[model samples]
Every structure is written in C-alpha cells, then in structure tokens.
Target: MKKFTSIKLAIAAACLAASSAQADTILGLYAGAQYWQVEPEGQFGSSDDQQAAFNYDDDAQGSFYVALEHPVPLIPNIKIRQTQLEVAGSQNMSFNFNGTAFDGKVSTEADLSNTDLTLYYEVLDNGLASLDFGVTVKSLDGEIMVMDDDGTSEMQELTGYVPMGYLAAQVGLPLTGLSLYGDVSVLSIGDHSLTDYQAGIAYAFVDNIAVDISAQLGYRSFKLELDDLDGIHSDLEFSGAYAGLEVHF
Candidate 1:
C-alpha cells in the first residue's frame, strides 16, 4: 500500500510539472499563500438561547489556494482554498453545553477549519479590469470542547456544507504595477447566515513572460451565525489584516 501511494504521488508530481511548463500557453494557473492575524469574538452554544461567551486570544492563521483557468468554451474555472481556524481560551462563567453543565472556570477549545471550492466564469477580462461570477461550496468539519475544573468535559461536533454566491473583481491602474481586488461570498438561509469578504491591493513586482509575481496587503472579515446546524448554534466573527504573495502563469 505504501509503494502504491508513492507511485501515485510521483505520477501526480510529474503531471504538475508538465502543466506548469505549458501553463502560459493554454492554461492560466494561479497560486497564493497568506498569513492572517485575526482576533475572534462571539458566543457559542448547543442551543440558540443557551450560550457561552468566547474569550480567546488573537492568533495567526495560514491559508493557501490554487486555481486553474482554461479557455474551454462553456466550462468554468476551478479554485480550491484551505483555511485554518482554531482558538483556545478560558471561560469563567457557568454554562451548559449540549446537556452537560459546567460551573466555575473551564478551558475551552474550538476548531472551525474549512475548505472552499469555487467554480467561476470570467465575465470580463480586459487589461484594465476583470470580473468573475461563480458559486462556492464551503465545507466545515469542526468541533468545540469545554472542560470543567473537575476534569469533566463535553464536546459538540459540527459538520455541514454551505452553498454561497461568489463574486470577484479587480481593476488595474494604468502605467503602474498596482491593482485593487476583492471578493465576497455570502449566504443567507432562514435563521442562518455566513459572510466572508476580503479587499486588498496587489503590486506586481515581478512580471515576465513565464510568470507574474505579486505582493498583497489586505483585510479580511468572516462572520458566521448558526441556528442549530449539526447540533450547534453560535455567532462568531473573525476579522483582521493579512499579507500574502501570489503567482500567476
């Protein structure tokens, strides 16, 4: 089994190298990585009316994405992004999580890592401006745990899929190697809603025939409000500034 997995990885690496070599001719490949310094705020609970506040410290998170675009007639481009969202803190108040009640001081940990898969069509792509319209499906596999002073604990697992609308736009400044870009994904269904947005400026420090590299500085905000999805209910927000690098070929 190990040898078979190694062979599959080798084949995949070879195909990726070949694709990178010819990406400029028939494919537009983009890859980016970012470091975000975010602060978490809000409350979480198993039921909407019964909740516990989160007192978390600020943390730095990492994210990365890869996208492939082609000129095929009605097919949309695809992009995949992975993000890390985990926080730990202590809560001093008494609360009930699920059916277990906790008193006095307790340690809390929550992990809400997610992945976004987007399929978008370029509505316009000129030298000066670009726009894309798409749909995104975000999957979350997360959990929250709280431990009391007596070593007793309760954990609630959260897993769900959310469908959202995606929109991205970019505009370039003539005679300058700078551009402004932003994207947003939003969904609202009944008592639940999610909104994630980012706006940034990019400087194309290295532009060539083979590849273009850019440095980015931006701010991002994510708001999640849940109403009993996967036996969890919460309202959380993560917002902060980020720095990143992007490469296109």
Candidate 2:
C-alpha cells in the first residue's frame, strides 16, 4: 500500500523530551529483519465475476523494521518498516482488466508492498507483558504485470498510500527466555479491505540491559481486496512461515 502521513509534531515532541531526560528512563532502539517464503493464490480483473486465476509457486519475500521507544507517555513511539511482496506464476487467463479483455496463457507477477511509518502508544510494557496500538501509513509503490509468451505485455502500476491501524502484543515466559508476540495492521473502508499480521515465538539468546539478541520464527499472512481502483481489480492472499533475527540496543 502507498502509505499515509502529516502527524509528526507530536512524535517530535516526544523525541525531544526523551533526549532531554536521557538518564531517567529507558530509551530503546531496535531493528529486526525477516525472510518469508510465500505461497500466493488469487484472482484479478475488473469485477468479481470477470476475474482470472492466479497460482504462484513458492517464493521468498523480505521484511525489516527499525523502532525507537522512550519513556515518554502520551506521544507514541515510532517504527519504520519495509516489506516486499513479490510473487510470480503462470496460467491461462481470460479476463477483463481496466475495461479491456485479454485472453491467453500468460505469466503474471504481483508486486504489492510498501514502507510503513508507524506511530504507536504503549498500552502496557512491563517485564512479562507488552502491548501497543497505533496507526501507520503504508506506502504502496509497486505494480502487477502480465505477459504472454507471444511478446504481448501489459502492466498496472499500483502507486498510492493509505492509513492503517496497528496493534502489537507480547507475553514473556518467566525464566524461559521465550516470548509470544503478535503484530497486525489493517484497513477496511468503503470497497477495500487489507490486512497483514504475524504471530511468532521468540527466544532470546542474550538478554541484558545494553544489548539483546533474539531468534524468532513466525507465520505471516496478508490479504488484499481491491475493487476497481485505478483500473485494476484484485483479490489476493500471500502467506507462509518466516524466520527472523532481532536485536535491541
């Protein structure tokens, strides 16, 4: 999704306050990256009854995030995340896209992804429990392209941004160095509904005040339902397991 913006002053104030009162509380900086092997299945066209089939083989997608959290109360913490959604497959499709009909055996590619800049408030963050809620602007800067083996090609550029609601929660097991975490972002309005979420277990190899390293394994699922916006109509789902590394400093 192409993302959303314009509410930076509140977060800027939080950062400023955190900088001024550095030694009184915790100021956490963290980064994480993951690789997901996705299986895609969906349909695309101008309308529901006039769509074409999509069956994609297994493929890998990359996602990463950087976040900053301080002792500030009301103003939200900041997390910047980038995810790539790319998958390709071959099929015999006959459908109408953007009001034009194309019929043939073609190779299709769907690239739907964006960088999410999120501002969230910590609802609860203690030793054993943590929860966060906020909003993000997902910048969709990708496209969908289809080509027949006979040199005929067509592409639909997906370039837009939308605001999504965000939620995250974590619960740690005592003395186990293990935790359960889930994160979600969703937007549903009018004729569009999009959602992405991940739930996983994380084991901390090294947990300390100054630095922490963790290994995480999780399942991620993303679904997109778009209705004739910008000439492309699509219903897509991409999901799979992921292994990731996260570090906090």
Candidate 3:
C-alpha cells in the first residue's frame, strides 16, 4: 500500500512540474509591412545668393521580428528576454539650387535606410497587458545628389555609413480578438539626433495569424560642414501615417 501511494504522489508531482513549465514562458516569431512618408522641413545651407529647393515623395517600408521571453525564476512577477528585430526603408528627394549667377537647377535624390538588432526585457506580462524596454545598435546608410536644373550642370552623388544608438519602450494590451500596441524610441547619431514615436492596434485571428496597423512620426536635426564655405546648421522634421500587418508563431 505504501509503495502504491508513493507512485501516485510521483505522478502528481510530474504533472505539476509540466504545468509549471508551460506557465513559465513563451517564444514567438513576428513579421510586418510598414508605409513611411518623410518630409524635409529645412535647407542644408543659408545664402541669399544660393537658393535651394527640395521635393520629396513617400515610400513603402517593411520589416520582421523574432522574440523569446520567460519569467524570471527569482522574480516571477517580472519577465526578462532577448529580441532580434530588423527594419529597412527608403526615401527619394529632389534638390534645386543656384549660386554665382550661374542660373542652375539640380535634381537630387537620397535613400535613407537602417537595420537594428536589439535586446529587450519586459517588466510586466499579463495575458491582457505588458511593457517592454530595450536598446538597439543601428547601421545607417544615406545618399545625396546635386545637379543643375537648367540642364547645364553635372550630377554629383555622396554616400556614407554611420552607427547610432537607440532607446525604446513598448506597451501592449489585448482586446477581444485584437491587441493594441504602442512604441517610442530616441536615437543619437554622431552629432545628429532622431526621435521616433508610433502607436497602433493589431488583430490575432489565430495563434499564428494576425494583422497590425499603426501611425509613425519622426524628427531629425544635424549640422552640415561644406568645403570652402561657412559651416551651416539645419533642422529637419517629418510626420506621417502608416498601416502594417503582424504575424506571430
């Protein structure tokens, strides 16, 4: 009788262990598509004799994310994890300018894109709500063009790469078959600065199928140094609306 009782107790303990493991954490795969519209608010240089004009058109952007998370053993109330996220986007712009009475117009275009790999940890995770904080290292690439609008100038293009750091926060809430999420991030690149803010909602029809829609706003400012000319400082700001999809596994 004692042996049988011991066997039953062992079975109960095993079931409890499995239940605890299932409750402890989760891992997920995610992907999405985003649309971005960038507008330039300021000029690169200031010279009454050198007048400049810019024209920008919007573009579509997309990205993917994979995440793994578990509740801390020592502090079960808090969740800790690591996440890998990557995003890329591009912009096309035209510039026109004239200096030294050499009446000229320049057609210029640039591509601004970056990829971010980050580690994120969450402080709160209930079935309905959660909060996350993290940092990311970003790789940036940019291009610029200069031309004569009067068809009498040569075309010049400049390209370079830079590294930047970002701090981000996100909050999520679930409602019915849909989940609402919002995120904000601040970035520092050399002497330049960028701020990004976004908020949106998502719907999950099943465990692995979902769609997300959001709106994003961004602002950037930096100083420009040109050869054989006085150093110029400028500020650029842009705001836009975006709609995207999200898939989870």
- Highest lDDT among the candidates is held by which one? 1
Better of 1 and 2 by lDDT: 1
Can you rank all candidates by lDDT, best first?
1, 2, 3
Q: Which regions of candidate 2 fall more than 4 Å away from where they truly are?
A: 1-24
- Model-by-model lDDT, in order? 0.91, 0.85, 0.43
In model 3, residue pairs whose N, Cα or C atoms come closer than 3 Å (at least 3 residues apart or on different chains), thus clashing, are: 105-148, 105-149, 106-147, 106-149
Candidate 2 lDDT, 1-249, residue by residue in tens: 123233476677778766644632568888999999898888877666777876688999999999999887787899999998888888786755655556677787778877999999987877699999999888898988877777777788888888999999999999899999999999999889889899999999997545789999999998888987677677888999999999988
lDDT of 1 by residue, 32-106 (tens): 999999899998888988878868889999989999998787899999999999988887888888789888997
- Candidate 2, RMSD to the unseen true structure: 11.6
C-alpha positional error of residue 180 in candidate 2 after TM-score superposition, expressed in Å: 0.3
The candidate, 1 or 2, that scores higher on TM-score is 1
Error of 2 at 135 (Å): 0.5
Backbone clashes, each candidate: 0, 12, 4
Per-residue lDDT of 89 in model 2: 86
Q: Estimate each model's TM-score.
A: 0.89, 0.87, 0.57
